[model samples]
Target: MENVMLRDVIVDDLPIFFEQQKDMTANFMAAFTTKDPADKVAFKAHWEKILNNEAIIKKTVIFNEKVAGHVSSFEQFGEREVSYWIGREYWGRGVATKALSQFLDCITIRPLYARAVKDNIASIRVLEKCGFEIKGEDKGYSNARAEEVEEYILKLS
Candidate 1:
């Protein structure tokens, strides 16, 4: 993957990014997602909260100069957690792995954390390749699945 880089997300990127996140397959694989992915008003408000907040680290994942997806980290229950969304078109191209490697370098916070739906082997593999270790498991409500899902928690020190 050439030209894979992480850059500060801009307002113009939100629409594109939100569309990527709204993919039903991607949302199902991720398990946790916005209550209603199609609501532009809600999507805009959500991105606004993320972009305006100083604590969140937001970045656009560029692949060969095209907007491929996004990788970002935010605090959950006082633990910083990694999360990402890859456009369905970009899946299986190693974009997530490459972009994740670069994003980890920019986030220096130690003992970082991440989670993945138990069946999402691809996402778990990306986190593991980046040096995050599976620490435990927990159940959470998945808005996309409309049910509780088993999630694996990982940690990096």
Candidate 2:
């Protein structure tokens, strides 16, 4: 895989972002979300908030000179953590790992954290490859799944 770069997500990227998210959300719901997409206006609103917020570090993952995915770090419940997603087409090509590694390098803070759905092996592997250790597990409502799901917590020290 070519070097993956992380750059700030601009306003123009919203369309691509929305499409990728819709696809990922649909896939995630196969085993998780019970509600119809029609009832998920709030979910779209959340992404809009991320897009408009200046405090949240939103980034686009660029691979082979194209937008391959997104990665971000933000504060939640007083803790800073990272998260990312790569299009299914780009999976298994190291795009996510490379993008996340570069993102981690830019984070000066120690003890950053990350979380992944318990069943998402690929995401777990990506976090692990970036030096995040599994710290624990917790139950939370995943909007994509629309139900309480087990999630793994990872910490970088």
Candidate 3:
């Protein structure tokens, strides 16, 4: 955790992000993800769109000087929301929590929102550690689970 850092996402980080997000277990835990996690073209296009958008605050997560994942805050449903994906190898080591803490420091938007599949206790814990509180519940079609999944809506103000 002490070695975790966040930096502006660069073009070179996309490949690492792609591989990290493609983990079956990681995707399943995330629940809401791109329809085809293995589609390289789609992944590239998605990153391109994100990188081109100045409104999005996206960063590459560096843990022990290696790209562990990515964290981002963007507008969704007319509200600002935060999201992050950490490689499974970095899980259980406080990587998500630390990365998100740093990212939140850069985001000044109040009442920021975040969501996590209800069963993803690790993500929930990370958000809570970053001062987000569960404010509501929602159900959405999860590409990873291929079903309607329940999620928690958390807010940080």
Give one digit per residue, the lDDT tens place, for model 3 in 1-157: 3599999999999888988878999999999999999999999999999999999999999999999999999999999999999999999999999999999898889989999999999999999999999999999999999999999999999
Better of 1 and 3 by lDDT: 3
Computed on alpha carbons, the lDDT of every model, listed in order, comes to 0.91, 0.78, 0.95
lDDT winner: 3
The parts of candidate 3 lying over 4 Å away from their true place are none
Backbone clash numbers for all candidates listed: 0, 2, 0
TM-score of 2: 0.84
**Candidate order (lDDT):** 3, 1, 2
User: Which prediction has the highest TM-score against the true structure?
Assistant: 3
Alpha carbon lDDT of residue 117, candidate 3?
Answer: 95
Error of 2 at 50 (Å): 2.2
Candidate 3, number of clashes = 0
How well is each residue in 1-157 modelled by candidate 2, as lDDT tens digits? 4768888887676566556666754358222332443434654677789988877887999888888878889997688988787776788899989998998888888788987788888888988999999999888877676678998889999
